[model samples]
Target: MTDIASFRLLQPLSRRALLGSAAAAGALIVLHPFAARAQANQAHLRIMETTDIHVNVMPYDYYADKPNDTMGLARTASIIGAIRAEAGNSMLIDNGDLLQGNPMGDYMAYEKGMKEGDLHPVMKAMNLLGYDAGTLGNHEFNYGLDFMFNVMQGANYPVVCANLTRGQLASDPKNDDLFFKPFIIIEKTIRDGTGAESPVKVGFIGFVPPPIMVWDAKNLEGKAMTRDIVEAARAWIPAMKEAGADIVIALSHSGIDAAAHTDRMENASLHLAGVDGIDAIFTGHQHLVFPGPKTWDGMAGVDPVRGTLMGKPAVMGGFWGSHMGLIDLLLEKDGKSWKIADFTTEARPIYHRNEDRKIVADVASDTRVEDSVKAEHEATLAYVRTPVGKTSAPLYSYFALVADDPSVQIVSNAQTWYIREMLRETEYRDYPILSAAAPFKAGGRGGADYYTDVAAGAIAIKNVADLYLYPNTVQAVLVTGAEVKDWLEMSAGMFNQVEPGASDAALLNADFPSYNYDVIDGVTYRIDLSQPAMFDKEGQRVSDGEGRIIDLMFDGKPIDPEQRFVVATNNYRAGGGGKFPGIAGDKVIFAAPDTNRDVIVRYIIDQGTINPSADGNWSFAPLKDTSVVFSSGPKGRQYVGDIKGVAIEPAGDGADGFALYRVKL
Candidate 1:
């Protein structure tokens, strides 16, 4: 077994002290600059990262019910095996969120019942590939503590997380909650650039967002909670170096969006990189790839071209195994200690989406991983494929952004039904209930074929899973009609600011996550493209000017500003996941412990046959003589005849084969 290094309490770290220690850490990395040239006892080692696997053990899409080349750790194993074969020394590590995401993970927890002796498919696959060390992602807590512990108990490798420990108050400055180890040091032999073998002590410390306590409060309340990631790093990193670790790699489950160098930031990787002792950082939680063109646009302190974070190598392996983050390091022996000489980063993909939208696969499904977890994989397939209910019309999200989509409609219907039933016994039953749902399978970065397509007929569990990808629980928040307007205005951020009349004007704001573009049922409104967004991505209002929302009405009348209404949404949104207005606080009136997927399934089963069609509750405010262009999957061509509202026609091919459409108002 590899050696485990317990984080001994050196000193308690206050918020101010953590910041001061972070300053000191930054100084250390700068003073110990990367050495130049090939010196005595030098070598090259490749660090392989498979982050946000999300329990996709097989090279298959459980939601799509087909073989997927882009996702799954099994496909990633082919990359790891090849990279390791070409390197003198290498370490394969995961960046967390391996426990849950899709139906297979759901099946393992709900149906298969992770018994005492049962091994999780993710654990089986990782063991077969020989993972060095790993950490937990936020999704790991979705199924609650017992289930998470059951999954981790089957692991053959050590998984560390500085935050999220059992039996401790998350609010305490210093607490003894050592349910899991904070860090681990691996002893490995690597040849220096001079081709001389030397021993290296590689230290690994993990961090998850402190917001997990709020995100998964049902599962984690009074059981496990997260501390501030930056604070945890400050307390543990210096201690790791003191424990004789040659190099420290931060397995941060946070993203790199934190421009402010402060504690408790959700995306704290940027701040963590500024710390002195961290040699490199591997991040996830945003499901975006570092050193990629998508994130290179004006991000501070990130050298996307070179894949460096604060002059140190960093990577965020594309989520769901779409890409494997690789960091090749050149190490040299300085006296007896190993120091980084040079390094490079690239998020290598299992398949490439060419400019022409062709999927060029790098390798086939890994037989080793497949065979290792063949039993569990097969069981999950059968569970999701089992027929649950029926649909009268085809359900797809091809033009979800441009039109009211049936895919999101079904989700809203489910939430609305669940909320109405739950509120019947309460005094709030008189209030109007509005359901908010977003298209999770809309074709975007997942490629042109990523959109959900369920033919009119028997709907399976897999089809329902496609409609709602996350395991978020149902929640109802009470907001005034004015707050509701602000909420809709925030969702309008998905569209780009448009001129009154221009040829081929861009429509979609590529920065705003499509998942946050919630279409609220039980209301009628129009998005005005001519106006700039009032709210930014962080839900902060940039202007009080006339917002894009026009003709906001409920029950065929203009909503009164002071009127009260109940809005149904998932726990993530209600807990301030997108920073939407009037959410995540005392305003939340109802919290249902059932996963939204279960609610969807129950709705489907309750309704013998779903009327799969959007209610046409919202549309874009007509911009006379103006045409806006937006992109959707090429599969959208099959459904343009069914879309309502403004006339939409195919313009041409878009990036990654996303069918470009011109909406002539």
Candidate 2:
């Protein structure tokens, strides 16, 4: 009943260079004009989506300072250009997260401040690509309204989002004071399967995660507000249909996770699809792809092979311009209004890791776009390269998980320093303070080289970028001692179950991301691997398990279960980016506008030379005659002697250029 598949060959197109510079005042390159109706009743409408780009426009990784094939819009431009050529009618649209994420974005905001008439590099690229419409994502507000509003002013295409509003009344589209237009109507000609052509009104309404109010509370507390995604969609979708929209597409800046933890859940793309009058949905925010075996195989309601959500076609282009999402519709003229007869969705990635672990370039970067932003890109490179401070010892995360690591320790120190200063002048000064940090560069899907290994001196902006990996603002969450134990239990879920006296048992859970493995710096605890994890990855309790986190203590005594503690964390975690219990929007007591990376930079500058030490806060409970096998970057071999609390040695090489090590529990 659905053609939500690309059974046909996904034509890999060479990215032809656009001759003109991408930075010029480029006119919108309209693809088949609506007034120029095609010659058939059954017309084709191909919708192209670039989701979660986060402002990476060029084919480069700023953190790595290398030619990256998997990221950047310039590379996807080739795929989009090829797809446009193959189709008779098509429109390019963005699925949000366009204005933030990259260090280049921070460079532009912090070093190269925006003026009244400045166009952001990513906005220019989207305009040059002839994007018909776009939406806003959660990261958009990270830089605040003035910066975002200034950037949005330069966009030639219409930007629409139904959820974000200035005030309570969202009834009248014109007078509602909505951040962007609620929906835009585009009249386009479609070539039906019957070889007939007609003009059909395709409407696009945008929705952002409702948690933005909490995530960007500093920027959005008074002036702006957000309604729940589903509620907002239901309210506007009916109006879109009544407004004579022939077919409607939901540009959801959300993800496909079916679990709704709250009434205003973060990832509600699936729920948004169930709303009436929405023909298709483009989802993002998780930075993951759909219609692939890895993410979609055997999921409920999702037809992975066909790329359908509840029988409706959906696609999520990978983040950082890694992939281009395409949805082709066969619209048959049902009298006056056109109805979708058939559709297929596919997410085409720019590069793939072959069996040999080599990253092959699937498409070349578009020079035209790169040329336009060439000056800005170079400026950003210099911006990141400028030295900030020095480190006494080399900072690396190769042994971060198995033992205390300076890489994670430095972040915790910076957070503790910043949070303590803030707490000193407040009523919360009486409560004890703790800092939580996770090693972001633990070398997973980004490859073995995707780890933090800063040499013992001269920390620059790029090094900070590698260390933190996000521009997340700092926040302090007030939690009871009981909740703190539960929180650590959730983070301890990163390890695999181990048996006593088991030889070479696997230690790490490959499915658990290193970023989710938060280590609390102020508390002494033991993670007993023999017991089951109390919480699953989604923060759902699998079982009321016993003592994974054992002997948790603070101030040289057992932690009082009833005592209150203020734990420092980033906005992403505090606002429920990770499904951790006891840390939600409501738990946040203090919100600092400074990003965690910036705090690290400031800490290093103030200290002159940072000495990162783990303070021996957390360790595993002893299990005699048992060893566990774990994998890390091959680079970990050099630091085996320095790791404490566990007897460790190199076992051998692991899959994908990693090293295997055995650690005595």
Candidate 3:
């Protein structure tokens, strides 16, 4: 069963505040003395995990410039001490994606470079929390190797990864020149039921998604390579066993997918769990949770209620410090080795939504974690608050999935403008330039409060960063009209097929990531929800039926299959991210050095007072007597009247505090 446990620390922060600023230099707070004893031959071990923290040291949102209850290491840190007091032996670990995500990460990389002896703010916070170990996630390679290496030097704990190689692979996966230590054997003292103390060796092996080769190709094309998650596990688990590890745990940065295992698959946690010698697993990189009601409902070999994958204990903490994954294990002595006799897993939240749809923090912020990075947090606030330009219309992504949106339109406009100017003096200047942009925050796994909402006023660096998330550089690709049509067909998989007369059928495919729902702005088309999707979520052709994209037009004429066009996109897509059709390294015509966010900032500055109204380049085709339902943040209700060419009304409350809306097509 899902074993979520919550215990309040009485006046955790208030005591520190009462002591005033003098407490900053005082001794660190300890929840309980580590003097508890367990029964002989059996022990209780609690494994705590924090994944995808993404540089959120304080309980604040840099984009909105306000305190947020949902995400922050400080909030998660409040319960760490209390959680440790419950078990005789405990280990706190991080499951990677620690380096980059929010504006603080951007500020550190761009504004404040990581020089020698300079510790990263996130690493400092994790060190203060006394993390035992951590692994590498795919996002760790985002800022390039030198910057990543500089940041890794600050980590106080052992960071291990079995799959990533520096230059080339050796003859065997075990012999590969690993970028980090393959696995570490952590020695610990365990207390048995008889109060007898003994030594136990816990081994942790780490693995990342193999697609980093494609996602960050610019930084990792020739300099690095990766082994498959399952392949690497099969090779290294034996070595860890021979190294005298009594119990083995796999820190898989990949997600859980029950699909048949293939080499280089992105979500291979289920397959990795089946490998021998792995006693338990910690999963992340999908920003999801195990033992949760939704997300993993009917997948084979995945028991959400029991929190098991292939019958092995597993947990995936929600991203951005929203949840802390805990796996409680009862270890029994079996001859020379320790076996997992029983276990209970949970993804505990730092905050909970009340009946009134407001967030109520379960635990107060841990003052020690907040104080560790106070200087960097303050500097990051100053950096993001610097004004860049102004916008005439509000930019939000509430209806981005259902209609053309201003938030995405602004990014598309900025990309098109930047690329047009970059290629104006080049040989390919006359080609028709189209920009493809997607909504990075559309309230999927990020929860209801994750959408981008910028008021129409003076915009700052944070607002521009919100307009275009990620640090991808601008890239222009040359593609034929046929490839463009297939591209749109691939993106159309975001919506689920609706029957012509069906009422309130689910509109969106929850598994489809919002980042892959690319909306090409220069072409106009209608998404026919009645038709079957030509491409699946993996960008593979799954049907031989009519495509969902209909009446495709460019310049008021039917697009020709032979006509070649220049598509302005980010390096992630041009380098084969999301497996888009006919878009890869060979098609890239111009790769600019400037980042996409920087280009947006430049565009806003050039326009001075910019207008970010969506031009309505795409829409849903009419299906008589059909109404589909979807959910967004409750704040979307106010902007429902601003939507064009569609009739949307409040349906009711949705699960997990989202407000459902019905759209008539």
Candidate 4:
């Protein structure tokens, strides 16, 4: 992580801070250093972006099966009318990941098949909002090319993607036959000052991360390939300028990173912004907002306060239709070419927290947008509510970080059981089988309310989805005992180092996303918070001598470093999603066709009922007189007595509507 001296690693953007920012969410604050030079030929163009929508057409959480104020295109669409009225000319575009996320997307792909003429709910919603252009995200390929193309057929606007190709890649980007149109120059007429209408060719290019080939290797192994994000941008950008395009805007579905550009780097938006011909950029795929004070505040090459990346106007709309990214540009028509005179960027949120920390919808759902997908929305509700199986215990992820959680436990159990059955007759049957699972809803960016909580008995499809967020298939990897230990060491980065006698030190690393904190079942380990973490938040080994993982054992004995084990995990980890050590594509021995969620459902149904209890396989090592505080949802207070293997008590309230709990070691 970049050095952020003023920012605290303990507490993320608090509810009060979000509330403070909400005040400006309604205002169009110009962050440009100087005012635009007034001229008769000057035109103000507003570019609106909705990225990482993930098929959230309605303001509803399909997993929780409830209406949410923080998400949905309907809520975002409500603001577009007022925003368009505030600008001289406007264009709305989506960055990508619109095809799949919640049960609505799953229902369409699985139960209600998408044919040629059938309009997908998200596309229908965007079409109603009159989106000008869109691009494909990595998740768009989750259901395979055929389903993706069928859904894309419903999009009224042109969808372009520059990087993805049918098969082999050529030496140069231009020589490659792309799967979609590389770029499009939209010929639009903008009314300039003094009532003069002039022609403007605005070029929009799109790029997805190169790792889509690996992430979706099962579906895209021989069918598709990709070029680096910056490579594609470098080749296509100059061509766009050569093709009579005046202002080029990049709809990059990649996040910003200041690290030196490497081959096939996932987060390459910062480097893409440095490309010569690109004028403005809209970025996503990290599910984070740009110009936010918390995350990208002091990162190199990023000016969150000014909403600029590599000195160009840039914005990232938060995921799931939480916010709409806006870039207001002052364009000066100098004879034939148009130049950007001044600009402002903002990510207007759909909701905010009140003074009492209660979420309030800042914008109501646009009824027109909601009515467009009303049928599918109701069908999705019914689909997710379908009974899957039963659970003997209540499953929740509130204390997943500090304990072996049932939410993750059930997934790990299901995966291990499925993998064991699959490998029973295979050569790998001799190897001890373990399973790795993580808490997908442990209240990171989604805030205090974002956690999985299921009551005992009568589990539904939505509850299973709550347990497993991504649509990743199951994979079994052959790893040695040493690699497994190192993997747990990497996961230990989720906790902060504490002094021997420290009091009330923050325990959880707020920057470390909870999804990456893998808990491996069929093994026991202890995390020594007194020692420096062997790996950094980015999964890089920063400490060689000091280690956090201690007393790691498998099958009730000290594991041999050379002993091989079959570890069942999701395709994302097997394909190197979190950069875990010694686990990648080469190590994957078996790739199952079924998704992890499906496996969980099958496991639940086969058993009829499951205990769904955490086995207390891992815990923090003794730290003398040390106490650490961590935050979870306020509802976690009721389950504090159920937490095993750790001593914890209420520490009072926390920021962002979270309740604090002190873990005494």
TM-score of 3: 0.68
TM-score per candidate, chains pooled: 0.68, 0.72, 0.68, 0.70
Model 4, 1-665: lDDT tens per residue? 11122111111122111223344344442222222333588888889999988889899988767788889988787666655655677899999998877778878987898888888888778877778898888889878899999888888889999999998999999989898999999988987766588889999999988877766676798999999989998999999999999999999988887768999888899999999999999999877889889678678889998899999999999988998899989989988878898899988787788899998976667777899899999998998888767899999999999999999999999999988877876689889999999999988778888999998989887788688877687989999999999899988889888998999999988778888999999999999999888987667889977488888998789989999999999988997879997788789887664568767866876898888899999999988888999999998888999988999899999888999999999
Give each model's whole-structure lDDT: 0.79, 0.80, 0.84, 0.84
Assess candidate 3 and give its lDDT. 0.84
Model 1: what TM-score? 0.68
- The candidate, 1 or 4, that scores higher on TM-score is 4
Error of 2 at 216 (Å): 1.0
Candidate 4, residue 330: lDDT: 90
Candidate 4 local lDDT, residue 107: 89
Ranking under lDDT, best-scoring first? Answer: 4, 3, 2, 1
- Model 1 residue runs over 4 Å out of place are 1-39, 169-175, 261-263, 388-408, 414-458, 465-519, 525-551, 555-557, 560-665
lDDT of 2 by residue, 610-649 (tens): 8875566888889988899988888878878877676789
lDDT of 4 at 295: 77
